[model samples]
Target: MRLSVLDRSRVRAGSGHPEALRDTVAFARQAEQLGYHRFWVSEHHGVPGVAGSAPTVLAAAVAAATSRIRVGTGGVMLPNHQPLVVAEQFGVLESLFPGRIDMGLGRSVGFIEAVRKALGHDQEDAADFGRGLAELLGYFTGDRAVRGYPADGLRVPPFVLATGAGARVAAAHGVPLVIGSFRGEDAMIDAITAYRAGFRPSTWAEEPYVVISSTVAVADTAEDAWRLLVPEAWAMAHSRTRGDFPPLSAPDDVLAQPMTSRERGLFEQSLRGHVHGTPSEVAKALDHLVHRTAADEVLVTTSTYDRAAMLDSYRLLAGLYL
Candidate 1:
């Protein structure tokens, strides 16, 4: 039952991107002191709400700031960059951090068509993820046609951030799988089952490893914990409805806004499928979730407008296990 964090470097309303990024680095230091297993960052291109556009660079900053906790990306989307460049970037990281770096890879392209074009990729490019993954792995193993400098013979653990089909890719590659819990329990279970069924032994992993990424908010009261989810939920709703993801707003501000039926529905939907409650309640839900999915680790990915409250939520969650 390992507990980890995946901070998106979320930009809060009234704050600049620099502050949000500095917050992430500072948050990693706190997370390390709190005894978390890993502290991972994320990548989002052209998303206003997310300041972590370059996860590898952010990961380096986090590693430099912390002593023990593992540092890596929640992931870097493979389709947007050349595998060789990605390998070199991580090669430099692993060389610097040694055993503390992880490579979490994802297949997602940019969020919108314009951003996708800017990245020189489109939706269809995501399908090439399998090929790209192989190339990236080959660099580390020195199995590719070209050598990847410091990357060759470097053994940085790789984890695939996947859904159903992506889970199959992870299984085929025989690396660890990092799946989200947002998509309903049944669907998540099915994906895990498929992943285990198709898993093959490779240098990366001898058996299937599953890390369930989830939104977990803990507080003194159930209502208070639920309130921590509001800002991100509203931002998600805004992205879906208005096609723009704004910085996180205070819970009170979000609650006071008038919304169309569609916006309201999406906002409500975003709030569901999370583990939020008092410490005891959240623990119970997480225990059940781990039991059902047989997850090797739990990656907490909770963001809110209030930084202090957010850190308190993580502190409470860490207290449950540490």
Candidate 2:
């Protein structure tokens, strides 16, 4: 029944970044008021629809606005940033918020071509993601470097978000791991098993903490939830068919488009992997996943069309959990 915020940061094409930041802060504040456990921003670059490219800054802003809810990244791509800089930023965050910050690192940038270019990188430029991951952990844990940084003091606790059976990294470091694979329970469990086997107890953790982050929405009625979820489903469909940087489709638009070829494939893939429905429905899915995976917590992602809908989604979803 645990719940946290997963902001898709649904900014439209003409939406201003300042406005998005303001809206995001407001959303975080509301999440805290509603008693959500955390507000985790995502790292996306060169995506017009998502403005959370700098999760550290956004996380700090959210932390400053709210007193209790945890604030951190659903992920910061280690391949895209310097380990030292990430260490200092999250260290500052930990200093400011103390025990209320969580750092989730990922191996992939949240977008494709434009995102790569924005980060001044290319497919060929990708760091050995595993190596970069180790380096980032080193900066925080006082292990990788022989000199100042990896040997210095930083109090940030970092987790790895493993989407495709890579949770072993989390185990090796003895930090928490978040896995949100659609329904690849077998794969997810396998990774968790690997992670637990590889874990080395650390200052931040003696045992494993695994959280499941999945798509979620809730409404007064099943039909209503379906209606609200269409925006998010369509938003994702919009991304795969048109590419991953466009704003969401209008409900009517998604309804109008006949599922075909690539779009159909994408929709089926997402449905097989994601959790989407009314509070009761989502709760059912949640319970099923928890029963199957024994996840310690759940992170709910709101990727709907508008800010209001997203807020309402969490309000209802969390209410169901309560």
Candidate 3:
């Protein structure tokens, strides 16, 4: 099984964006050493906990810092920028990194209305994602009326960040699909099936390829692994209630906080499908998940309050299959 990373460059409670970004670069190097196939950075605009607003920039840093490991976005939200500009930026990255760059694009609007306005985007912009993606691809393949300059001759492997409509867009374009299903297993299977059924044979890919991204953590004990997930889960719950995604707190701190019934419900919802346990247990669940989803690769998107423990979890998970 091919294991990859999708790092959000998460800012912990006490750490700032600089520390989180530095950790992203350092973690990419470690991931390469640990035999991860690809390292992807995600883009989240106006989020306090996430520092990866500009994934292409972060991808460039990661690519410069590490060799051999494929570096790219997990992805760049396409509606946030013009297609030509997106093409040019990735074109430059591909020129710098050559065969090691992946252009993963998504169709998400900003997290909130203010953020959407700041990006000069709205829900209507998301409606034009397919058209934007087509334009982006045309620039790469040199098939459009407009040119992408340095990117014209480049062959950056494009993958769509799979959401509901995004999966179909990937199928229509014959690019790979990267879906995050940390909520349910059945949903992942349905997405893959839909992609395969609608996939067209384009030069980009002859057949459908799927990459599943999920929260995975491994520790010496099952209980300990669950402990490592608490911070992030609590953060998710907090986001639902407060309309802001806060930086992760310590697991003990999260656990000690009093919760209302609604908060408790949301917290439990966040915990679903988070594959955390001992190595053997996590391995078994991941195997089942990969098989069920027919995933060509699995992207581990694990974030925890404990940075050292996060590294250990990746190391152990890598040992299990890498």
Candidate 4:
């Protein structure tokens, strides 16, 4: 099956305070026309580089602006939040958008040690990610017996964001599992096998659902797509391999920007795992993505320096689908 696009609502270059919100609304509207399935925002805090720190607030806006595309987190980092609060927030979203709302959960500070400590957590709080998962679900499923409350039986459905041990948690709880496609395909096979083998049906989820997110860039030409992808590609590679986000130059200006050999290595290896190329190339990658994850759905994590180029990329990919 063709892959489904999941917009990251990435902040545009030189974006103002409201730019991310405006881009999100516009992106959602345009994606509706392009035939994408769902548009998910990410979560980050104290990071000037990211704008999706409050995905729930933004998800409400996206839901109101678009009619068809499902809206939710690509993965909400649970370590920094309260489970009951998340449950209530998404619960209300579910009430408003109905079946169009998805609650993909995650287990990370999504920031860093300094930032996480500032946010009021110790290094050991990550151990409670499993507890946070249960609490968030209890709030959604009206499982008062478990520890959640937004007033009575009001509940929303939930999904798990599986990365490392999160895969096992998803399996144990029988929630939908979304492996971070930013990583690689090896863990995907391992996680999916684990989730299916260990799944236990829940009130919200029956069969095991696998929704892996991929950072995809499609354009009219391979070179053009690669050009549009440099900023995001550079940022992700720097974060994982080097512990920071590197400086990103303009698409037209990247030739002058210099990167170290190590930086290039990370950038290249990370790029190899993602879907980047023309529509035809992306289509082939997506086909392989489907078979590898055995995912019920594929969520395309799109990015660019600005919203126009990002929007163009998504539109082009949508055309490839039909």
Candidate 5:
């Protein structure tokens, strides 16, 4: 299976945004050297633990830093952006990076009400996500009234970030679908099956393409890999209970703290959903995931408090998967 990298630009508890972003760019270079297919960054608004608020801007930096790997947003939230603006921003990136840029779009709105208002979007705007996607795609095809400048003729392969109804939308557009593996194997199989069955031919794609993103970590032993996932698991549990996604903490500190029954349950559930183990173990799980979902590519999204360990994890996975 083809392997890709998805760096969320996660900030550790003690580190700042600048360091997080620098790590993202550096990680992109490392991923390229490791023979990964593509390196994508994400977009998150008003999240303290995430430094990737503007994926296009970060993608520009990544493209400038790397010469081989394709760089783009893991996605740009469509509900939070104007279609023309997104088209133009990615158009500019495509102008520079040419065939090496992706335009991954999503249907999500801001995580909070205030953040939605800041972006001048409401919950109702999410209903227009399909329309926004159509508009953005139109710009590239020269069908829209307003041109996307350099993007009019350029082929910026658009991929939808699939979740729930997103699979249907992707099928309708005939674009590639990018889904997360945290939703369980059964759900993933159903979504990909439905997408392929309903796909319609378009200039962008003639067949179904699925990219599965999974939280993965690899180490010398199964126990060590699980230890590396603690910080992110704890952060997810904290977010569910506290309504905020805090920066990752040291695994030792996380394991030392006492948790409420609810937090403990959430933490364990989060841990269960991820793929973490020794290289052979991770490879087995990933191979199963690929066969089950018929995935065209697998993107690994792993974050830990220790940068060296995190890099090592990627290297280990690349050695096996790539």
Candidate 6:
């Protein structure tokens, strides 16, 4: 199975956004060296914890920093931008990087009502994602009335970052589907089965391709690996209860804090679905997950406060599969 990475450019408690973004670029170079298939970045608007707001721009930095390995967005939310503009931006990326670029698209609007208003979109705009996707694809194929200059004939591969009705949209459009594994195995498998059953052949993809996006952490011991997940879990729990996502704190520090019943519940819940263990243990879990889902690729999206530990976890994971 293909092993890839999706870095959210998450900021650490002591770090700034600039450092977070630079770390992403540097991480991409390291990922290429580790024999990873793809190194993709994410987009999060006005989120304090996430530094990767402009994915295409960040992708350019990553591409320039690495000679090999596919680079793309985990995704750019279609509801927040014009389809034509999205096409053109990707076109320029394809023009520069050629076969190395992947255009991963999502249907999400901004995180909150105010942010959505600032982006000139509402929740209802997500319903128009299917139409926007069609228009974006049309720009590359010359099927639309207005043609995008560099994009008209460029064959940049498109992948749908599946959420909610995303699998259906991907099936109709005949593109690869990138779906998370956090939602529960049965639900994810059902979505994949439905997507394949409804898939229609198109120039982008003749067959249904599924990439299971999951958080995986590997270390010398199972306990150490589990510790690596603590910071991010706390951040997620904090976001749910506090209305804002803060930077990752040290796992030890996070563990020391007293939590309310709600925070504790959410924090523990955040840690449950992820795969975290020693190298051998993690290998078995990942193998089983891939087998169960029949996934074409495994996109690792692990994050932590300890940069060294995070890198070590990735190295151990790469040793297992690469």
Q: Would you list the C-alpha lDDT of every candidate in the order shown?
A: 0.95, 0.74, 0.91, 0.74, 0.91, 0.93
Q: Which residue pairs overlap in candidate 3's backbone?
A: none
User: Which candidate leads in lDDT?
Assistant: 1
Model 2 clash pairs are 182-273
Best-first order by lDDT = 1, 6, 3, 5, 2, 4
Expressed as tens digits, the lDDT of each residue in 164-196 for candidate 2 is 445766776678888875657787777777777
Q: List the pairs of residues colliding in candidate 4.
A: none
Question: Per-residue CA lDDT of candidate 3, range 1-322, in tens?
Answer: 9999999999899889999999999999999999999999999999888899899999999999999999999899999999999999999999988999999899998999999999999999998999999999999899988889889989999999876788889999999999987647777678788899999989899999999988998999998999998988998998889988888899999889999999999998888778889999999999988778778999898899898999999999999999
Higher-scoring candidate on lDDT, 1 or 5: 1
Q: TM-score winner between 2 and 3, please give it.
A: 3
The worst-scoring run of ten residues by lDDT in candidate 6 lies at 109-118
lDDT tens digits, residues 165-191, model 5? 889899999999999988888888888
Find the 10 residues in a row with the least total lDDT in model 3. 182-191
TM-score for predicted model 2 compared with the true structure = 0.88
Q: Where does the lowest 10-residue lDDT sum fall in candidate 5?
A: 145-154
Residue 166 displacement in candidate 4 (angstroms)? 0.7
> Any idea what lDDT model 6 has?
0.93
Q: What is the lDDT of residue 156 in candidate 2?
A: 64
Candidate 1 local accuracy as lDDT? 0.95
TM-scores, each model vs. reference: 0.99, 0.88, 0.98, 0.89, 0.98, 0.99
Candidate 3 Cα errors over 4 Å, as ranges: none
- Candidate 1 per-residue lDDT, tens place, 1-322, comes to 7999999999999998999999999999999999999999998999887899999999999999999999999999999999999999999999999999999999999999999989999877799889999999999999999999789999999999999899999999999999999999999999999999999999999999999999999999999999999999999999998787899999999999999999999999999999999999999999999999999999998899999999999999999997
